[model samples]
Target: MQNNYFAAAPKYQEDSSNQQTNTEEQQIGKKAVFYYKMVAKTLGQYLSIYDGKTEYKMGVVMHQPAKPDHQGGFYVYDSLDQAIFADVPLKKDGLYFAPRTVIKCACWGDKIEYPNGKIAFEYLCPVQDMGMPKGYLATKAAMKEAYQLYSEKLKLKQGAGPKSLKKPTWKN
Candidate 1:
């Protein structure tokens, strides 16, 4: 399969004179053109760089910040396939996805598979912000289990009203 991707090329003639140098340069140019054609054929329209805000589409380059902090830097939407394909570094603040985007997990460094069979690593921001990637919440079954746990806690609290009331409602 790998061999099918790269065909064996004919050996070049030895450059005995300066005119041979021109032939060598032509060969190099031909090889470059071939590579460009291959890239265009494989990536097609995805090869184009997206210009505008990340909100415009998934794969657009949002903005590159001048000063990078522990939780602030570059951001982009997942729709910008070229940015991800190029392996662009995420901002220290982590890559931001649109709210409607489905996050497979909240944990940083998790691998998320795209519909096209491409896999991307998740980078969560250490600090919470408006553009931070949102965590995935429980679905139907998990939500049901959470509801059951809440009910059980309520039952336990009813048995010890004054004692339970003394405890803080918010969790640490």
Candidate 2:
């Protein structure tokens, strides 16, 4: 799939006088976007997220954090499909989630597969911020498994390309 640029429109460059400089936040912002894109190319491949019209982003609904990195109490998910998220006018709103059928990240807490072949993940990270792109307990398992597998394949001297030529996670 092509890159899903940020939720907002891109700000193009202008003349040198008005050109944009890379501030720390800007750099981190770019890295964050890249990290999200990496997610799309790797674990996203195993998911059937594209619903024919709108390509819903993988949104993580988390519980309160307490024991881990301490970034929490922001998103307390009580429902699989947020009422505000359903049938949204394609790509217009960014606060919504794909549904229980999508949003397959392990960081969502606990993954539950229904009998209808639709998968749902619960928001269970009450003590840790499972929202981080990496290093978090949840991301290490199913989240980045595809990337890890692709890396292992590359090490065997096999003519293997990336699960999309995936890049390493951003560092501060």
Candidate 3:
């Protein structure tokens, strides 16, 4: 079984930038493109950084074909397979019918098989951030960098560093 992961196109909103608005289409100004790209860049970086790491668990939900054995029931594969007896297309767009499954994780989990031959597993998902990548060392590093940058901006705004704590000169 092979492991396959994919990233979908970002969902863009017309009013995301709030610069200009069209009553007919309700579209915003040109800033929306930049804003959308920024969001996509951040998300792409987060995903890439996450995939580059070794300590992660992943899962996928795919559409299976109609098999005589498992008729009507869906099929889940260890990896993406375009050719399967019980394969189902994921999207409804074109006639290709490629399965529109979501690989929920970047790694595998403990293998558990059911009596009915169905397989189940758990992925390496951190508890923080509500089952997403949180508490990972790399994630922590990324967050630390972001925090440092924000802290620097805050210092510039306040005209003082983060250490400038206003301790009461005279105790109450």
Per-candidate TM-scores read 0.20, 0.19, 0.20
Best-first order by lDDT: 2, 1, 3
Error of 2 at 126 (Å): 20
Summarize candidate 3's per-residue lDDT along 1-172 as a digit string, tens digits.
2222222112344586765444421221111110000000122221212122222223222222333433422222342221122222232332222111122222222334334333333322211112222332223345568889888788766767444553334676
User: Candidate 3: worst 10 consecutive residues by lDDT?
Assistant: 32-41
For candidate 1, lDDT tens digit of each residue in 1-172?
A: 0111112222345565734233542453243210000011111121112221222212222222323231332223333232223332333332322122221111122334445433333222211112213343223344467888888788666664455455566678
Taking all chains together, the TM-score of candidate 3 against the true structure is 0.20
Residues 20-69 of candidate 2: C-alpha lDDT, one tens digit per residue? 75544344334321101111123333122222332334332233333322
Score each candidate by Cα lDDT. Answer: 0.29, 0.31, 0.28
Name the top lDDT candidate. Answer: 2
What would you estimate as the lDDT of candidate 1? 0.29
Residue 6 lDDT in model 1?
A: 16
Error of 1 at 1 (Å): 39
Q: Is candidate 1 or candidate 2 better by TM-score?
A: 1
Report how far residue 62 has shifted in candidate 2, in Å: 10
